[model samples]
Target: MKTGLREKLKWLRKPDSTPATADNTRATEPDRPGWFIPQKAESLLATPLRRQLMKIIWQRTSVSAALFAELYQTPVARFAVLAQQLPASEYHHHAYPGGLLDHTLEVMAFAAKLRQRHLLPAGAAPEDQAREAEAWTAGILYAALLHDAGKLAIDMEVTTGENQLWYPWQGAPAGPYRLKYRKGREYALHPVAGCLLATRILPDSALNWLAQYPELMASFLYCISGQYERAGVPGEVVQEADRASVAQYMGASAGSVLDNPQPSLAKQILTALRELMHTRYRLNNPQSGSDGWLTADALWLVSKATADNVRAWLLQQGVTSVPDSNIRLFDEMQSLGLIIPTTEGKAIWTCDIQATGGWSPGRPLTLLRVSPERIWPDADGRPPVFDGRVSPLSSVPEQPQACGDAPAMSPVDPGTGTGGDLLSELTLSLFSGTDDHTAPQASMTPPSGSEEKHIAGDGLLTVVPAETESQPPPVTEVNPPVPASITPPVAACSGQNFTDWLREGLLTRKILINDRLARVHMVEGMLFLVSPEIFKLYVQSTTGSTGDEWMLAQKAFQKLGLHHRGVNNINIHTCQIRGPRRNSRVKGYLLTSPEQIFGESIPEDNPYLSVLEEGSGTAT
Candidate 1:
C-alpha cells in the first residue's frame, strides 16, 4: 500500500486513549458560565441522543468503532467544544442551549443516510466508486458537520467572563463564555466564514486523505465554502440533510428524498391563524374594535393586521422561517391555497366594511377573504356567524368547477336545520385522519447526558427515521384520497414556457420577487434570477426532472438570448449582496432587459443588491 493509505489505515486502527466510562469522560455538569467544560469525544457522545445518532452514523458507514472514532468522533468533539451551547439561530431551528451541537450531529446522521442513496465521484466506474466509497462518506460527514461552523465565527460575538473576545481560530474558549448574535449581520456570509475554520475542526490526516481525490476535494471545498451551486452531489446531500433537520426541529416533515421540497410552511401558517383566533384575535366584535369579521360565506380579516400577527405568532412559536415582508407572506398564503384570491388572482382584497350597528370604515380597507369551511370544519365548534352581511366590493375570480370544491353553504335556515349537519359531515370528510393540533415545537433545552431515552415520544427533538433503513408503504396507496382542487395544475414544461410562467407568476404575485426567499430579484434595472434554484424549482414543479434534465433547461433558457452574459461569455453572473455588517456574493443569471420579463413597468431594484461587473469575481 502507498505510504499515505497505509498511514490512514494505521491512524484508523489506533485505539482511543480516553476512558469509556461516562462519569469520567463526560462533563455532566455545567460550569459557572452554564457551558459544559470541553470533554473527550467519548464523553461528548455519552448523551442518549448523541449516542443514538452515532449508532445511526455507524450503521450507515458499516465501519468499526475505532475507524469511526478517528474519522467522525474526533472532529465532532472539536465541533462540540467550538459550538458550546450556542443556538443555531437567534430564533430559528435548534435555537436553544447546545442547539448548534445537536443540529450538527443530526445533520451528520441525516447526511450519512442521504449519502447511501448515491454513488460518489458521481459518474465514476463501479470499481472506482467502491474503492473511494469510504473517502466520499468521510467527506460528506465532514461537509455536513462544518456546513454551519462559520456562524460561530462570523455571525456571533463570543466573550469570556473576563470580557475577552474569543475566535474559533483560538480553539474552543479556555473558560466559560457567553455569545450574542451580531446586529445587522449578513445572512449569507456564514458559509464563507465557515471555510476559515474548517482546518481547525478537521484533523490534518483526514484532510490529506480527502485531498488525494481531486473531484471529492473540490466538491467538499465548494460545499463548506457555501458555493453550493457548484458543489454537485456533496452539496445537494448536505443541503437536503440540513433542510430535513431544520424542518423536523421546526415541527414539520422534510418532504421527499432526492427532491428539495418546500417544508409545510402553509400548514404552519394555518396553525398560527387558528391559535391566534382562539387566543388573541377578536372576531365580529360590535361594542369594541375587531380584528376580523366572520360572515356566512367568508372570514374577512384586516390584511395588514392579520399579516403582522401571523408573522409574529409564528416567530414566537419558533417558526423563524416566516417571511419578514407582508407581501411575500401574502403571496405564499395565496399560492398555497390558504386564502381566496381576488379577481386578478391577487392575495389582498380592497373592501368596504359596514357593520349593522352603523360602524363603517371611512374608506375601503384591504382584507384577506378565507372560506369559512377552511377554518371551522365542524359547524358546532364555530362561533356564531356575523348577523350582518359582508359585501365584497372587489369580487374574487371564479375557479374552475371541480369535484373537490366544498359544497357551498346554503342560506342558514333555522327551521330546516340544513347547514349544521352538512358542515359536520364535511368536517368528518375533510379532516378525518389528521390531528387538529399542531405538532409541538422541539424543546430549546439540550437533552441531558444522563437520560437514557427521550421522555416525550413526539417531542421537538424526535429522531427522523433513516430513509434507507426501511421503506414505508407508498403514500398514495396507504393514505386516503386527497381532493384535486388543492393541488394546482403543473404548467407545460419548456424554456419559453418557464419564462412565460415566471412573468405571469410575478405579475399575479404567485411568484414573489425581492424578498428573502425570493428567487428573482431586480438588479441594475433588470431581473436577476438566482440560477439552479429558479431552474430547479421550475423543473421540479412542472416535470419532476433531475440531474441532466435541469442542465438542459438552463441551456434551453440560455438559447433564448434574453440573459446578459458575464466574462468569458459565461451565462452566470455574480452580484454583491451588501448588508450592514458585511458583504456577500450571489451567482445568478441577469436578464438583458427588464421589459422582456416585467414589460415596461419594472419593480424598484433591491436596495441591498448590486450587480458586479464582468470579471469582478468567480462565476460558477
Candidate 2:
C-alpha cells in the first residue's frame, strides 16, 4: 500500500475527521505579520549554534542552497511560522517561554548527523542506493524536524497576534502569535497531529520523490506517527536524537547506563547557570537566609549546599537525567565558566564563610567569583569581606553532598511506550539511544568542521556591549558621577547605556582600549568612543537580529548629548593610529567630561591617540 494514500491513517484514528492541511505554498505576507514581537527565523537560524547545524546538514547531504530550497527550506520556513515562539515542552528540557525553535533546530542537527551513517536502499543494488541517497537524507531531516510538529495540536491553544486561534489543520498560523499550554490535555497524541500536518509543510514534490522508496517511506511515516516499532532505524535515530538534545540542555551525558562507567553527555553548564540566575536561583543575598552570598568582588556558595540545591531543583523540574555525581556536576559547572576555581585551581574551595553570628569551622565550599554584572545589573552597596578564617570540615554529612543521587529518571525502554502518547513519558533517559545491539551510527570520523571550543575559564571571544556586566537602572550621564555614586536605570540596550558600558569596561579592565583597533579609549582624560566599531558592539549586544541594527544605535547615540563637537559642526572626530603597514583614520566621540564615566579618579590620556584637527586630510 502507498504511504499517505490511506483515507485516514490508522495512527490518526479519525475516520470521520479530515486531516489538517497547511497551504504548502509559501505566503507572500503572513497573517498579522507584526502582531506580537516577531522573531525572524532567518535571524534566529543565523545564530552561531544554528549556523553550525545548517552547515552540518549541507555537508552531510551535499545540499546546495538551491537544492536545500527544493527539499527542506520551504517546510522549515513554514515550521518557523506556525511555531513562532512556541516552546517544546511546558516543564521539561526547553521549558522556557520560547524554547521550541531552539529545540527543533537541535533535533534536526542530531538527525542530520545520524543520517550520514546509513546506506539507503539498505540491501539494494549499488545503482539504486546511489540514486536514493539524497531522497533518504531528505526523508530523515524532514522526519526529525516534523517529529514534534504535532505538539501544536493537543498541547496548547496557539493564537496569532490578532487573537485568532490558528489551528495546524488549517495550515501554519497566519501571523504573529503566542502560546499557552493546555491544562489536563493529552500530551502524547501529538504524533497523530504530526502525521496530519506533515503533508502541509513537506512539499508535494518531495513527497512524490520519497514515495519511490517503500522501505524508507514506511519507516519515515511510522516515525512520524510515533510508532518506533515499525520506524526501525529512523525511529531509533529520532529517539536517540531527542534524548541527546534533552541531555545537552540538562547538562548530563546524553544517554548513559546506571552501572556504566562512560556516557555521551550534553554540555550546557553555563546556560544552566544563566537560567538559574534569571529564573530560579538567587545569588548575593546579604540577608540571613538566601541561596548564596555575594561579596565585594565574588559570589560565595557552600559547595555541597549549592550542588544539592541545583540537583534537587533540576529533578523537580523534570530534568531527571543529569550529572549524577557532584564531582561530574562540578566538572561541567567549572568547565562552563559558571563557577570560580580556588587558588589551587580546584572546583571545590575550602573557605570559612562567616555571615553574622553563624560560621562553619572550615568546610569545603565553592568560591564562584563572577562579575557583579553577570548576576545583577544594578546591584549596589558592596559588603565587606566575610569575617572568618579557613578551617577543615568537622564532620561528614549522611550522604556527603548528594551528587548524582537525586531521584534520577531511568533509561527509557523504546519498545514499551507509544511514541506519540504522553499517557506516560517514554522515558528516554541519558542512555536510551545507544544500545549495544543497535546498528552503528553513520560516521565514526569527526567531521572536518568542529564546534567552537570554549575554555570556560576564559570568556567570550567577542566583546559585544550587551554581554558587558554591570548595567544598572539608567541615571543622569549629564554630570560625571563618582564610581561609588549609584547604578543608573537606563534601558539595557540603549546607545546611552552602551556608552555607560564602555565607561564601566574601562573601570573594570574588562575592555582593552589601549590596544590597537579598540572601540573605546581614554585620550586627554576624555572618553573617546570609536564610532562605527563602538556602534557595532552596541548593536551586537542588544540584538544580533539585523544588519541594520547598528544604524538605529547610531541614531540613538546622537540623541545623547555626551559628545562634544568642534567648530566644524561634527561631533565625530577622525584619528590616525600608526601601524607597520600604513596609517588609517578611525572615527569616534570625544566625551565632554571624563568624570561622567571614569568618575573621581580619571585615567591619564592614551599617548597613542593622535586626534586629527579640523580640515586635516592625510597623515603626513
Model 1 regions more than 4 Å off: 1-8, 11-43, 254-620
The sequence of per-residue lDDT tens digits that candidate 1 reaches over residues 75-107 is 887787777678786645565566787788878
Candidate 2 RMSD to the real structure = 24.3
Clashes (N, CA, C under 3 Å) per candidate: 1, 29
C-alpha-based local distance difference test score of model 1: 0.64
The residue pairs found clashing in candidate 1 are 442-460
Write down the TM-score of every candidate: 0.46, 0.40
Clashes of 1: 1
